[model samples]
Each structure stands twice: as structure tokens, then as C-alpha cells.
Target: MSVNTFNHRWASVILEALTRHGVRHICIAPGSRSTPLTLAAAANAKFICHTHFDERGLGHLALGLAKGSGERVAVIVTSGTAAANLYPAVIESGLTGERLIMLTADRPQEMIDCGANQAITQPGLFASHVTQSLNLPRPTPAIEARWLVSAVDNAVALQLQGTVHINCPFAEPLYGEWDNEEQAWSEALGDWWQESQPWLQQPQSRFSESQRDWNQWSQKRGVVVCGRLSAAEGQQVAQWAAILGWPLIADAQSQTGQPLAYADLWLGNPKAQAILQRSELVIQFGSHLTSKRLLQWQNACRPQEYWLIEDRPGRLDPAQHRGRRIATAVGEWLRQHPALPGKPWAQLLTELSSAAHTCIEQRLANEFGEAQVASRMSALLPPHGQLFLGNSLVVRLVDAFAQLPIGYPVFANRGASGIDGLISTAAGVERATCKPTLILLGDLSALYDLNSLALLRQSSAPVVILVVNNNGGQIFSLLPTPIAERERFYCMPQQVDFSHAAAMFGLHYRQPQDWASLYQQVTQAWQHGGVTLVELKVAETAGAEALRQLVQQVGAL
Candidate 1:
């Protein structure tokens, strides 16, 4: 297609450069100012564009895609609050080291600070969260087209570090006529337009530790703690843990199937704590463990030495416990060091964990509740499927109850750990993996991103959404708020059900009244390829009380 106006020409080059730079998917939110970019993305066959009415959801959708596919994903939105809406996702991407390209459209320089509609200070909006931020001038004959392309190339290259924000401001006639004049200007590119290669390609760099450091670090009686890791990375860490005879304390989001079962529960018990505290060193890979009890145990143990192996550049240890932080991939660290067979350091804890798991099983055997549902879902999820866990109570419940299923990948937005955008993020994961995905969210969380249900319609694989409806934010029930004021202040109960929501989103809805029905619904959803909402209705106070009772039982053991 020939572009006539400068806006059309600029949009074409930007979108074309993004595709050439290997951005396969683009999430777009509708607005007038961003029409040119949106239209250009739609016309480009190399880009798969997803439209969302809400920019907040759109940003998270791109985040999900980036995390799930392990590739850079772009998000386009209009000026003003639309760009501001992306701040949360940008913050998450920065913290998690995910590659995201944010293309925000804005008004021309003259329109800024003049009380113009849909115009705001678009530059540096994301603050320190973005890896790179650039404000591009409006397209003009004075500026070389190569400059624009090169800017895109550099911005995308910088995304290797984190999210890249490019604020593009367009002049009047945002959507102008496409004529031969613009086509002639574009033709000046000659062979560049037809080439599949990026205008600029930058090599990525890696960092590793000295073999002597590893040799010294590996000999200590250390425990292996795996936090949020990719499935492949988790497997490598698990293998290293087995070779070293170290106890692997895998977080729920670690996706390490071989982690010590009920490690969190065991840590809460005094007997198990005594065994774990004997360790002289702690080697942690990955970041953001979901268990507070486990974190407390780490602090209480106060090991003589703590080592953190993480490739990402950030402070993974908030407690300043890691004496040495090795900035390298876990696999690379494993490859550099020779395996040393040592005596089992966590055997007693492992034995105690087994008893804890058995106690949990007996407690939930006859009782069907939120924790039971999480346990059942953990066992029932397909080996090849992906599990997207919601934050707050749902993630805690899974961490405490769900057994790690082999070959099943687990994902969550643990960076910010907010309840917002759970559904949209899961949809993005489904889009990227093309695998059966199960999302376990709470009633309040589901409502926070309810509009994201529309995104599920585009899923290519089965997506079973298990909404544990206990009225409202039941997590508040566990807090120290007075019981009389808890409901009005903390657990704001939303008595509404999710069946109507499922119907509204064209998803198959099932209100499972018992464990059998819940399992049957999930199985059907997994077998059938579409979106399904399985709502588990339980008492609002029941989940909190159940957790309290379980903790008591495990502590007594």
C-alpha cells in the first residue's frame, strides 16, 4: 500500500521496523490520535494485532505475551491517560526483566501545555521503570527517514535490558490521504523496504562467575531455594539440587515439579524448622518466593553464608543476606562447576514435609473448599498445560496446598503482585503458549479485570477459569482488622455470582457445588477447546479459617 501523508509514511516505517525487529504481536487500544499507527499495524501482515478497549488490560496482555513467549511484545495506545495506564505493566516488566515495547501516541509539541484535548506530558511518564524512553518529533521532510528507523532499531535493542518506551507525537491531519507523493518518499528506501532484516542488530552480552567462586560456594551445607524461574531453568536447578543433595525449596511459581512437597508447611513446624536451621549456607536461584513462612524461616536460620545466582540485573535479596550475588544464568553456573556428591542436608526436613503433606490430605479429603479446589486443580491440571495463578489468597492457597505437578508450567504476576490484570495476563499466556491454560482467580480479582474476559475469545487453546467466589476479598479476613468492621472495610463482599459474567463473555459457565462437579467441569473444559468459567462458591470466612486450622495442624506436627 502506498502512503501519501507524512503521518501515514511515518506510521508505515515504524510498524515495518517493529516487525523486522522480531516483534510478532502488538496489543492496541482504540483512540483517534493513534489511528494512523493502528491502521498501519492492521495492514502489516507480519504483525498480529490485538485490540482491547482498556489500555490497562492491553498493557498486561503484552506483558503476558512477553513473559510467556520469551520474546519482545509491543503495545500501542493513545495519549493522555491511555499512556499513563501502561505504567503498571511497564513497572512489572522492568522489575521482572521482561522485554516490552511501548509505543504511545501523543499530540504535537505545540499542543502540549496549551490545554489541548488528549494531550499531556508524554515523555518520561514511566519514570525509572522503563529501560529506555524516547520522544520522537512529528514526521517532517527535514528529518531523515533513516533516523526514525534507526531510533526504532536502538529502542528495540535496548528492550533486551527491559521495556522500551517510544512516545510518538503527530501533527494535525493524523489520518490523511494516501497518495503517490508519500509513496514516492517511501520508495526512496529502495531495497530497504523489501528486506526482512532489521535496520540495526545489536549483540546481546552475558555475565558469568569465576570457577573458583563456584568451587568454594558449592562445598557448604547449603539449601537450594528456587523462586520464580522458567520451566527449563527450574529443571536445570532441580538437577543441580539433586546432584548436590541439597533440599530444593521451590516457590509455587517456580514450576520445579521436584521441589520438596509441603516445604512451606514444614517450615512452619518447629520440628522441621530445627532441621532446616542446621544448614550453614543458602543458595537461592530466581526471585520472589510466595511463602511468607519460608521467608521467615530463611531469616530465622541466618545461615553463615547466603549466595544468590540470578542472571537478571537487580536486587533479588531484599534482606541483604546474600553474601555473594552471582550474575549469571543458573544453567551456565551449573555447567561451569563440577558436581560434588555430598551428604543429604535436608533429609529430615524432607521426611517432615511428607508428614505435613499427609496431614493436609487427610484434612481436605472429605471437606470440599477453596484449598481443596486448589489441591484438586493442581493434581488434575494436564501435564503439558500452563497454570496462571491469581495473587492474594488464591496464590497463597496454591502455595500451601497444591502439589507440584510434573511438566506443568506455572505463571503469575509476582512482580507487583496486584490482583489487577490477572485474566488479561492469562489470556496473553494462552496466546503465546497455545497450550491448555488454567487460571485460578478470586471473585474480586476476576471483577477487577472483567473486561479481559473478551480477550479470552481469541484464545487458540482451552482456557479454564476457576473463579473461587467467596463473596469478596477474603484475604482481608486474615488481617488484624476488628471482626465487626472487617466486612465493611476489608472484605467488601460482592454477593454476585460469575455465571452471568461467563454468559456475557460467551464462555461456558458452571457453578460447581461439590468436588465431583468441579473436577468434571475442569475435565470437560480441558477436553473441549474453548473458554470456560468454573465458579467454586464457598463461605467468605471459610477459606481464612481453613488456612488457620491447617497451619495449626501442621505446627502441631
Candidate 2:
């Protein structure tokens, strides 16, 4: 019953509350200030502790775990820049509505802003990005133990909406032995410690659209746009689209199998674009579409009515096109207002998409280019497996070329959409799912998150990291940047390869030169069940040229 030091006792109670509240994973970055929390986590048998040396990667690792497991994950870090390193992941969690619990160890009020070592103004650090931030007073016998438990409970509850930050301040003597009197303090907890339940339970409120609101646009000529949806939610959106006879423009991240395939291509084609503009209404289920062409279409069409259905409370409609914002889940809203069978309004668009898909197939066939590699990977993805797309050109390539296997869940750091944490995020996904996880990233993204390659060693599942090495940010070549300045400002060329990187990380490395070789390597890596880096080397300008050619062919069609 003697839990020893005040810091240990406080850490114990906080961790207990988190575990009882169903937080299964705790990511820790070692630091003197965070010794108490780290030791407490180590002591707790119910929690799975993951250690990361880099706080930034550690933060995104937690983000990926939360995303992959669909549960709240906690991250513990020391004060000063250690806490600051988690800012990017915190921002990502806020935008994606992922639950992350940040337990930052800090110095007490006296040390903060007083030139004390490893101390800074830690409170309100994440500010508005976090759903809730609480600065706990320094551990002391005077502070009520129940109050600490209650604070954790509240933070866990708030995390259902987004990330929660709990900053703990501790004075020196962070670690110490137990005393006889401390035994009584432990026993005082009584049934609170014995019961494997949270000290407090808070119910989450569900959002539902009013029937009147639903009825207003139920009969209009519309299209369902699915963006960044879960596989289950994507299925629901697809069902709604089918029943309502609306064309479903699904983003690669949507995980919807029945979407208008090659819709991006169709939207890019002037002739096909005209056909898609027939819709009088636009109903978007999620946000952050990977295609700029789709956004442009929405802006140009300026539909009479635009209704966005999403669970998160954010302005997803960046184009200001949403006439009505239904802050509710797509499935919940659909359930509230059952879809009545209607005439097919998007038959023309669907047919055009089919033609566009055929055109893309022809363009990618027999070509060992970036688009072909993406297409092959998408086709080879195992059923029910997970795909984590990096930012830059890779996600767009997959969005355009890949024919996703049915029910395969696609993940991306699209909220912030930065290339810093893709590898670490994918590692977290692999850790959580323990399934065949494939990562498609470009050379720039791979280099940006190069340090995260260390995380692959910890993954229990097979992770096939397909890095399309175009030598640099080849995406810039496709832009309107002048040719003379492209390499300096936009391309930022890197002449490095991943063969040595793979060896350094102890992964199976292969650089496939042809389509068949790449496909074979991917399949073997995925089937063999270990970490592998399949680098597909393409010319720096090949990707941009392929895209241009594809658009031209689609336009011709």
C-alpha cells in the first residue's frame, strides 16, 4: 500500500485513471522531468508503454496509434522543447478529431520564467489546438488525491472531442523511497484503487440533423462527395449515394469502393467537367479532398445548394460553398432521414468516369512510371489491409491511379498534410493493427521523416514502405514555376537513394526497374511479413509528364 514518493503517488493515480478510462497505449520520451510518469507507466501492467527518443516522432506515433486503434492514446514528455515538439501532432489531432492525451512534466511555478533549467511557461502551450489543457499543481500531501483522479477523468472525457493536455508540475526530489505514514495515504484511496473503473464517466453527445433540414434537399439533383472517411462511414456514404442515385465523388482517403472511379480525371477533363456540373446540389460527407481539380469544380459550379455532413465542428468548406453545415455523422443523418428511391441523376457523370478510368488504364499500362507504380501497389494491397499515404505527389498519384481493393482503409496525415511524420505515423498504424500495412511516399517525404525509419524495427506487423524516388519534389515540376528556378526553390533535388537507408534500418530493400518487378517485390514484401523498403526509381520529370499525358488523353476521350 506504500506507493512511496508524492510524485509517484500522483503519477500512479493519473495513470490509473487513464487506463481505467480505456487508454491502452502510453508513448514516453525519456527525460528527467518525466521520470515520475514514465516509472508509473512502467509499473502499470495494463498499459502498453512505447518508448521513443524523438519527441516529435513520439507525438505522431501516438497520433497514428489513436487513429489506427480508434482509441485515445497518451503521450508523456518533459518540459520545455520536449512539450513543444508535440505541437505538430497536436495540431493534426485537432484537425482530424483524433483523441490524444498529452501528459507533459514541467517545473513548478517558481522555476518557470525564472531562468530555471528545463523549465518554461508550459500552461496553455497548445492553447486552442487541444480540446482541454490543465496545469496540475506541484505534487504535495496537501492536494486531494481524488482531485487528481477527477482531473484525469475530465481530460479523458474531453479527449473524445480532440487531444487533451495535462501539464504536471513537480519540484525537486522527484523520486524517493516510501515511508510508513505514506502507507496510510495509499490505504485512504480504498475502493478507488481496487475498482478497475474510471473515477468519473462522461457521456459523449451525438449529433443528428433535423428532418426538416434533410427534407429540404432530399429531392434535388445532387452528388455525394466523400472525403477522408473511415471505411465503415464510406460504406454508408456509398449506400446513400446509390439509393439517392447521386454520383459519389470519393477521395482516395474516403475508403469508399463504389465511388465514381477516375472522378479526378473526369473533373480535369473539360468535357467531363461540363457533364459533372449538372448537379444542382452538392452533399459532401467529409473534408480535405486530395484533388485540387475537385475544389476548382466546386468553385466553378457554385451549386444552388451545398450541404456538408461531418461529425467534427470545423469549417471544412474552405471554398465557402456550403450553404448548410450539418454538424452530424453522415450515417446518423442518413438514418434520421431514410433515402427514398429516386431517378438516376448522375448516370452521365458515372459513364464519363468509367471512360476516364479506361483512359488511365491505357496510359499506365506497360509503363514503368510513378503512376504505374501507384496503380500496381493499389491493386496489390491485401484485403482489409491499411494504406498510409504520404503528402506531396504520392497521395495525389494514388488518388488518380490506384484502384483500391474493396474495404481497404486508407490513412493520411491530411489534416496538416505535412511530410514530417508520415513514416512514424505509418509505423504507429502497423503497431496498432498488426496487419499488412503499406506506406506510399515520395523521396522528399521519405527524407523528411527519415529518422522515423527507426520505428519500423518496433513494428510487429509487415510494413511495405514504397518510396517513389523521383530525386526530389517532382510535384513542383507539374506546377507553373519557371524552369530555371524549379530545381532551387521548388524541386529541391536530393540525389540520395534508399538502398543504404533500408540497410541502415535493417529492412529488406529492393529497387524495382519495371512494372512487373515492382509488383512482384511489393507482393513478396507484403506477404513475407516484415519491414521492407521498395524504392521505385523514376525520372525526376517523369511523374509530371505522365500526369500531363494522362490529362491530355482524358481530355481527348
Candidate 2 residue-pair clash tally: 0
Please list the residue runs of candidate 1 whose C-alpha ends up more than 4 Å from where it truly belongs after superposition. Answer: 1-4, 182-190
As a TM-score, model 2 comes out at 0.95
lDDT of 2 by residue, 158-199 (tens): 665678999988777766774565545545778988898778
Count of clashes in candidate 1: 1
Judge candidate 1 against the unseen true structure and give its global Cα lDDT, from 0 to 1: 0.84
For candidate 1, write residues 110-134 as lDDT tens digits.
9999999989999999989999988
TM-score for each predicted model, relative to the true structure: 0.96, 0.95
For residue 78, what is the lDDT in candidate 1? Answer: 93
Q: Candidate 1 — which pairs collide?
A: 4-179
RMSD of each: 2.0, 2.1
Least lDDT summed over 10 consecutive residues: which range in candidate 1? 1-10
